[model samples]
Target: MNESLHGGVGKAQIKLRTQDFPIKEFVCQHDPLYIRALFLQAKTEFLLLSLDLTSLTESMVYDLKASVYEEFNIPIENIWITVTHTFSAPHLDKSYPIFIKKVKEAVQLSVSRALERVTKLAISTDSVTTSLNCSRNIETPFGWWLGRNDLEYSNHDIRILKIYEIKTDHLLCVLFNGDLPPSVMADSYLEQGGKAVSSDLIGYTCRKLEETVTQTAIFILGAAGDQRPLEKSCEDIVSEECLKRNDLHEAGFKLVETQGDRLYEEICSSLVKPNPIFLPIKAISIYEKKVFLEEKVMPIPTKELKPTKHFDFSKTGRQQELTIAGVSLGSIVLLGIQPEVNSLFGEKLRELVNVQTVFIASMVNGAIKYLPEEKDFERVTYTAMNTQLGRGSSKQFLEEVRRFLKESNLSVDKQIN
Candidate 1:
């Protein structure tokens, strides 16, 4: 075995406040979600355990990468972070200086804790259940809706894993699936505080899951760019309360208090087996795919067009996020792609990779908008503008993936081949 290439192991943790009271909503309302940083260190690698604050923004992601990289010596791609898409949390973008300061400090503290935690732990892999889910039920004119109007469709299979210690049996991390979109509290009044924040859901789930086992379980949201719970109902209320330790705010704080203990107890009893150790840690590969672009500015229907002409998606659109098939290995075989991929993409990638257990994950690396089917592009829905990335965008992205796979020397269809 290469001395420098031993198994990469790491652990980290951070806790940020998930509460914010922005008296009024702004044009860029900060999605309320607690941002937790889980840092992991293994051999020569250092990764940041990022929990979400509402949804992820390209600029914010870039900021995190830059800050973490500058503070700690690590490769950019190695520092992976994800959001829980909690809507009821605090918004760092709010104008209230106090709110912003509180959030910044909270994030910093979490980051520091993560750095401290990562240096003190070992890493073991374990698989958990793919539970606690259902497709988003949007009441559309055409009846209940899930994916875009695209002819191609796909289903999301939520996956989760635990990263923890060997001796003390502390759960240092959790890797889970699902998009953390902050759509749950779409119409929440800031003072009322009943906005849906996903971080609490993840944190509560993790904390509860931890009690069930001996380790800390952190959640990494899966391909949920397009997945969101419809309406802020009792279910969401119960889910959010799972994370509240105390009723600080007068708002939804009491929501979690109602059955928080009961739910936590339930999670404690639902302990599953841990993931197996990752042997002979091989290589990690990343690929970027671009959805094709349209040469001509697709004209919008007169009725659909906003008077201001801002591409009124209320009228028409196309799929925004698109990528070719993928193959990854760890606890299971992962066929990854992005931008709310069609169900067919997962099946096709499964065939291409030919793994024993194929898991399809969307929004793995970065998030594109949404990728509708070609036919939907023709009809021009709200997603069409983004999905139509010109003529050869999809093909170009495929080529990029092929090149990345070959260069990285990651295997595909090892069993079949």
Candidate 2:
């Protein structure tokens, strides 16, 4: 079941003119926000609800899960809720109780509708290349800055998981897992009297795909902690110059349209191809690890004094339990981890797994700051500085995932023999 949770006309919104505090007035909606639920009942029954929101808190996930289980009698563990990480969407806050109510109602409606018309599913996977994203960590004369890092390693692969209705062979939902947010075009609206809220690239892509397929389109953010959409094309001298000269208005729209069209073409082509391997859906495995933070020695400043230099570096025995969730669907696997994971970790996992397709959905379950690779600790990058997990925490987490995948593969081989 799919329903809109759009906060409508006048409401407090997030990621729009953030400079303005206590935003009371509402902005014009460019597109509707949605909550799409896809219920599966093959070897195992489960519900995957995708939200077009900025982010979700752990408490919200727990509440949504409890509500669904209590009403539908489905296991709480069977529910998987993910967000598109749309910067222009609303964030949960005390000021918006009505918005929360609408979300709960939408989830129930979507689940009920999905349960009513349960259909056999056929899955196909494809990829598309887009010049939209780049690493945001750049090295400057003073220090490393959070900007466009063209030389840094970033995932440009846009993995598409197309779920189809077996009987009619119609597209049910298309899950777009990419390392860029749809806020490129919407951010351009900021200078033009920041009274416009839009889904930007993502919403536009979905609308275009729906025009032909008439199906639900879901966007899941990948490891984009250090990644951002290209603000300017190669033809442009600089992003700020384009924005200052009002060139971004036209260029940004064209880029969004071209990229959306390219993705749509890929989806159409993949749908026509035959021989999609359907794997029996397996149970999801949740692994939890308690991570402890340790104090690091700060280097004395030789240049101007920074605020961080004055802060006390003390380990107050701060600890967090990180959860890693893995679900296997034949050769394709979906791994969801809490917090914003770095692209490097995702790349390493893919190389180790060697699967046909492994969709690494970041910011799942809960947000725990950033999860950067062990090597990232060497440099004072934004992700490393903002992370709660220790230096080797990411490596340890990846090892656990690799072990689980290996054990599962061995068990399947033995059963086959």
Candidate 3:
């Protein structure tokens, strides 16, 4: 396939999320968050924005989409905005109007710069298997807990999308999707009594990769509902009994550095590999479908779940209406999902779908909670309880995705693996 790929890649650094707070509240010492944009044009336009933040609300995404559309004349569906799911960065709250403004400005600037330098592109795809994360669903005396289950499943394969400037064959941007959450320092605190706002895993690694290659790199969070970093700074990642201060709060940055180093090395080694396609994309079709999910109700007596965060399910509505969105770039489809989908169900999706590759942005647009498979409900795992969707929600969502894929002409009567 041969075609010209237009658009460019750009990034803008973000100030500390807690910069306006008191001295004790300041979190970042070294690493800074960023908003990166990748705008491409084939048959369908694509403007993908990757944020080094935790999450984005549905309403916020809508407004951001509108702003990008106003600036770039791109449709809302063609704009894919996603987060790194970095726990180190503080969530956006009502009081952070200044930071919000900064974010909005950064988005506009990044996209504007990208549009100014629009260039033809060539693309290639590759993947590297990793064990950086393990399933965080463990069975204990008290039901399934949010802990390391080393023997359990995780999306070990990191998908790579390398985009290059066709004229010079210079790497312009690289998008890598991994299953690990950038939360290695999620619970780490400073010795002087403050939390740090480092980029954690994905952001740190991406920064390193960009510096090494002298190009843009974006981190897309993959299906990681049941996955967690094997190297966490907290003591109780395995269990509450895992003790107090498993890692020195101040030295937790070292763990993050190590995690980032491991990830960076893996990707750098595979930056250019054997037999890459480097094909010019033929076309792109952005598609989405609405799915209404019922809130889960336990049928039997179970231990009360202590979730880390509780989203206002009621605010969303009586039934959760999530979208199964995708950007089909010829044979490849980039899935943009709001919730953290279980790795197994994500695999099921790959098996059922007929696309050459399906790289799922696990937590995009919004964070509803984890969506585990129907069989996983029996495990009574933390994901099962933490999630708002009822049993079989994952299955229902898979069906909806399949239907949408067929409707969009992105799938055929074929199976993958």
Candidate 4:
């Protein structure tokens, strides 16, 4: 007989209210930051930890894994750590080492609280189609640039996972998959010594969910390498050169806040569903497939690059190779990729995986950079131009994920447990 599934959820604030370091002393405070953890217990255990900050570091990651392993015998591979990928927060620079130290302590406490409260928890899956996000890749007279392009490919579908107590039937926590970076204020004028540490969309919206809903909400980045908030912080981004350099994108705090409010309202539609369909998670397991792609993507001349409207995805969509990893909670499979992926690729991979239900998250494990679609290589979109990965990289990534899912028997590697 399989071991019964049990889960616990815990969250602790980073107490950013009085923090002085904000990368360049440009940001001060908007709301308190937090680190949340969800512990899944079974024959094999997994700790899913999410941070509100911008990203993670090697020392911070390894140290937390070591600490968790010391406290609980779960292996390092089973401890999954992902960030909200908020762009307006502090950057990983000279002051990161100190800030990360505090993050480590709070994260450890949250994990401990979760582990201590292991109880029977059931999961229900639902999704909401939203227009809060749009494709950021646009065709410039100069070439592909970073601008709002609603006509192009954009992922409006957001996957939601609700964890509820099996005994009381009360919702315990919510895990929502964010398709884009929480970067609405990414290029804002906050750089002009604005004393405010904003969480942008992901942080702002999720924090609201926790406060109003009164349940822990953990955010996981989905295929959002090319997606951006429909309401961008600044306006009139003219040149591709300026966009790439992060030079001219200006600030509009009101725009980002409005976007957050819109996203929060839309997500609530899915959250407050009259009834939810829970997955049969009798057993839990994790799987991963690694591909060694060393060939660097050579750059195409900007003048020769094509625009977004020129390429037809139906005819041009192709597959190639990439590193794919995932975990199975019974029938529902949660897959992850390390690089930032475009919205179309995310949808394509989900369709090909052949699973009854699957959620593909990007920037998982760690963030390598952007992985634009195959045709983007020919067109040299902003992503295609900036990514160090070579042509057909995204296609290859899809092909590998397809293979991984098939071999894993619906994309889940069955092992000890």
Residue 415, model 2, lDDT: 16
lDDT of each: 0.42, 0.62, 0.76, 0.72
Q: Score residue 285 of candidate 4 by CA lDDT.
A: 80
All candidates' TM-scores?
A: 0.62, 0.78, 0.90, 0.85
Segments of candidate 4 deviating more than 4 angstroms: 1-3, 17-19, 57-60, 191-195, 239-251, 297-323, 411-417
Question: Model 2 segments beyond 4 Å from truth?
Answer: 1-26, 185-195, 232-255, 272-315, 403-417
Query: What digit string (tens of lDDT, one per residue) describes model 4 on residues 107-128?
Result: 8888888877788877778888
lDDT of 2 by residue, 1-417 (tens): 111110010111222233433333234555566677767654555577777677788899989899999998978876778877766656777586666776777778777767776666666678876667788776544444455678888888889887767667677777778787665553344334443445566777777776677467777788888887676321212342221223354446566677667666755666566776554444433333333333333333423222121232233455567666666665667777777877776776666566678888887766666776654556656566665566666766666666655664512211100
For candidate 4, what is the TM-score?
0.85
Q: What clash count goes with each model?
A: 46, 0, 3, 10
The TM-score of predicted model 1 comes to: 0.62
Tens digits of per-residue lDDT, candidate 3, 1-417, equal 244667799999875444465423454555788899998888778889988888888888888899988977888878888888887766766576777777888899888878888888878888887778898776654456666779987879888888878787788888898788888887667777777777788888888888878478998888887888887777553444532236578777788888789888888777757555766467777887788877765432334444322222222235788977878776778878888887777777776567667787876766678776755666656676666787767767777777777887777564333
Worst 10 residues of 2 by lDDT: 2-11
Clashing pairs in 3: 27-196, 27-197, 28-197
Tell me the alpha-carbon RMSD of every candidate: 8.5, 7.4, 4.0, 5.9
For candidate 3, what is the total of clashing residue pairs? 3
Backbone clash total for model 4 is 10
Candidate of highest lDDT: 3
Please state the error at residue 119 of candidate 2 in Å. Answer: 1.3
Rank all candidate structures by their lDDT, best first, as comma-separated numbers. Answer: 3, 4, 2, 1
